[model samples]
Target: MPPARSDDDTDGTRAALGTAPIEPPVAAWPAVGTPADGLTEETGQAKKPRTAAFGFIFVTVALDMLSVGVFVPVLPRLVAEFMGGDAVASAAMYGLFGTAFALMQFFFSPLQGALSDRFGRRPVILVSNVGVGLDYVLMALAPNLWWLFVGRVISGVASATAATAFAYIADVTEPDQRAARFGMLGAGFGIGFVLGPALGGIAGGIDPRLPFWIAAGLSLLNALYGYFVLPESLSREKRAPFSLKRANPLGALVLLRSQPQLMSFAVVQFLSQLAHLVLPTVGVLYLTFRYGWDTTTIGFTMAAFGCAAVIVQGGLIGPGVKKFGERAAVLGGFACGIVGLSMQAAAFQGWMFWLAIPATSLWGFANAANNSLMSRRLGPSEQGRLQGANACLQGIAGLIGPLLFSQVYALALAAPGTFPGPGAPFLVAASLLVAALVLSVRATRRPG
Candidate 1:
């Protein structure tokens, strides 16, 4: 016979689960153990662990930025090389590249996020990384603009890795520790942003395609690393039922309406992305036209911005969230965005351009904090859905921001002798950020 239970033991078991014996909850991603199967209690075989899985996700993101930056320095020059130094055609082609990437991301991010939820995060990540590597190889091989568009489409699919990565982090981490992990990813982004462009600048000195080759190599390395080491975070039992319609970005809109807090985050996302909208496209062109910066100079200036951002978001931002609270961090980030844009508009000399460096760094710090706080508001069950929604909001902002900024950039270029030089669009970006600051301040009053 089985051992007899004492009366007290029976009562304790009853109390634990209303008349059933209860098992202790398992700790997730502990320092020593492999994650067990979704429905099984047994722990899996031990494997070598590296936090670089998280860093790999960020590297993918940073390389995407690098690919953009690499092309950026040589874009005008490359068009010239091919089209007999046609400044207008170069500008148009450059803008088209930006438009293609943003447009494809807008359409694909939610789809990838949903697919990861239904299938598993690891597979999605592997596929996306491979896509990005291929995108770079294509860019390197492309003889003309049409191939560049193909490369953008391929890269955009992989760019969704970032959203899936955040979902993967959510899957593995405890609620309290998530903000710090998210900050680590942000920091990785900052590091990549710093290194990729600097490398691109160096490659640009040799050949425009060199940066693409380097990005491809880095991406290939990431894909190989993930295949061997990165474990699946999403469990088969916990995954939501997959639907093609859910994969459609329109589902994110429905999610926005269902969750009030998510709606608020969507607003914050739109504002933050809008603030960044000017930087990648118009910002680079503005600096180049206004200061007569060469590719290396522009690359270094961008790298400085990335370096400062990495420091603040990686080190300071996480602690700020824990100390002052997410609301404060969000408000602070918006405020910094306003300051950064204003400084960019007001700066005259080439060196004065550095003023926007700290401004953008502060922006990065604050935005990181805000994203962490937003992620905290959702339950584990909804992590991928919520992150996918967030990405959709960012995608919308990216799509619209470029269109708006490109128009302003064209206007400034058209009438350079008149208007406020190239600084007019930046001033507009500042004004928009100021409005966003007020909105973020108002959001702090809601319940966490």
Candidate 2:
């Protein structure tokens, strides 16, 4: 095992690796001709601006998530509409939609990341935003299942925006500041979730197709706003040539493996992402089966979950990281996940189910901390590639997660007396999370 890295050794590690120091001296940060110059000027933060480029990216992420959330409340019914109202068939078809999206993301994420590295963050992001807007419009106008599937494919291809967004964040922020910034980003997602589902449910209640139009409008507006205000974070000198070998998903994973410190964290990220799929895959079905929750009730529950996430990621992550360090934060967050999943699995009543939401929100701490850890290990030029690889990993997990959990849930439902109840998927999630926790602990303990 390599020796553990201390905070004090950060600069030394960067210097020894011949990489730019992760945290340059404050005086050097705003120096003319430095990479930070554009960021500083844009934010008017001679020091750290109150709201810098990251703030815009944060809003971009929030809006992106909001568009996604708006669709959630009505997707099942939409699927059922095409499937002749067979709930089981609709559920199966919905999993396929999710899988198609993930499959496209898996193939394209690294390509998008590599493109961002070569071209620039701004164009890639803007294009993705435009694509998402079109996708929403397409979904809204879909006349049949084929059209819906086409729309999903387009949406999946455009989903590469997330990887580019993370790469943008890494370009502008220092390593030590990354976790907090990522926490803020996660908070944006939380806020989006809070507003999107609730509003979507209301709109969906009135007209099932209304939310998609609204979502499409939001995506277009977001794209227009970004075109005017978003600045390029990657300096020309830092740009790398794009290569097909580096752009493929398998190639991306291989590139990730080239970094010893990143491999374990990547695996942990994969497992955690897979485990999280339980929420989207089985969450609605489980609730409906177990508690007879309707769309409105499920929307409210998701909003509440988003609220808890907002509180924890926005409010607690920075302090939690400061108090216990990234490793501890990661471990503690995973611990919370274990507890939350277990509680969710055992909860028989609605109130008991609600209680688990806040507990699971702690998982955001782990996500932000792990991202920070990984970001710090790479050089500026490598950020896009790394993030893209991570995105591909996430894509793979997303592809597998829904299918796995849905199958498990279906099987469990079919044999309720032999298996756990609707909450059986949570038990499976808890088990995966346990493995992730163990891997995280071991990985963090190892020296870089």
Candidate 3:
């Protein structure tokens, strides 16, 4: 019992039942010009919802950092367990562990960057998450120092996600928006540290190995989430062929040389990174040996530090930059770092140590500002390369910081009369921050 075949009825039927229009193939989509910040441009088909992408990236980074924070509070105690209560030997071995991680990062970071450039960001990031999960599992099962070292090596090789993640941000965000966005990214780190160390401390109190298993579980879950939701940011047409020449870590540094200003900024970056490394390398040990702090106390202190970071990086950085400009923010950040380091070095009372957290959190502003400034100077195609170079510098700092600070700490503990104090390493770090501040000031004075 169909309706009568009027023209209107026929038209309505066609509208309701006719085949839906087909979307253009991804290859056939028109390419759009992105902002002239030399970062990645989006094509029609490649453009997805950016807010979702940013959220995913933020969460992923937070989780990655969280796992790190969870283990840090227990790392020194775990080492002590293996070394028969010899603080000096434990400190020395901790340095070796850090060195192993850094060595792997130095060699592999550029390769990951280059791979992201060719294949895609999603696959590399997913793989990294999986690797980190497995590494944590290995560490959880480790019965001795050698096995622990193996875990660190694996983790380091898998930790190139940061650089690639930065490149992903560069691909999606406009130049003017990058600073604020980067600040938010820093916030993700802060939040991770906030939850990770605090929980790790509590969990470590129950059983030091429990946090590792928990961290592994979280990482594996992250990988699974990413496999389903993460989208490709780089388009095939914009991707460059991977080359061993560009993939070499030493060769990656050469790219910075091509931009003289970037080279100066790189040095500034290096000094800051080097100064910051003293904390994770020696913070737990120093607190344990000097202040006689337990795992829970160290974790809470780290959480406090993380809270400060969240406040500054998440809430204050954008306004600070808007009010003072990027250069001034960099200078101010370094100044805060010097003050904080000095406080930590001289802190005789436990409360004095807690007071330094907010001041040191301001140091993160320099990182976001400096990175945003340098990122703007390059084109889209170069974002991965630039991030890779920065990763190399961080790797170098990681390699040197633990060795220097751990040795200094051990030496101070071993011969309290001969050396200044266990805080000698903090003083050294403060000096490095001073150098970084001077360089940052000098770089700002130059004509662009």
Q: Count the backbone clashes (under 3 Å) in each candidate.
A: 0, 2, 4
Cα lDDT for residue 239, candidate 1: 75
As a TM-score, model 3 comes out at 0.80
lDDT of 3: 0.79
Overall lDDT per candidate, in order of appearance: 0.69, 0.80, 0.79
Q: Give the top-scoring candidate (lDDT).
A: 2
Worst 10 residues of 3 by lDDT: 19-28
Worst 10 residues of 2 by lDDT: 19-28
Q: How displaced is residue 64 in candidate 3, in Å?
A: 2.4
Candidate number achieving the greatest TM-score relative to the actual structure: 2
- Per-residue alpha-carbon lDDT of model 1 for 353-442, expressed as tens digits? 796778667776556655665665554545677678778887888878877888987887788677566777777787777776776665
User: Candidate 3, 189: how far from true, in Å?
Assistant: 2.5
Model 1 misplaced regions, further than 4 Å: 1-50, 74-87, 143-145, 288-297, 348-353, 406-422, 446-448
TM-score of candidate 1 versus the correct structure, residues matched by position? 0.79
Q: Candidate 3's error at 76, in angstroms?
A: 6.7
lDDT at position 197, candidate 2: 76
TM-scores of the candidates are 0.79, 0.84, 0.80
CA RMSD of each candidate after superposition:
9.3, 6.5, 12.7
Task: Give the better candidate number (1 or 3) by lDDT.
Answer: 3
Error of 1 at 120 (Å): 1.3
Error of 1 at 139 (Å): 3.6
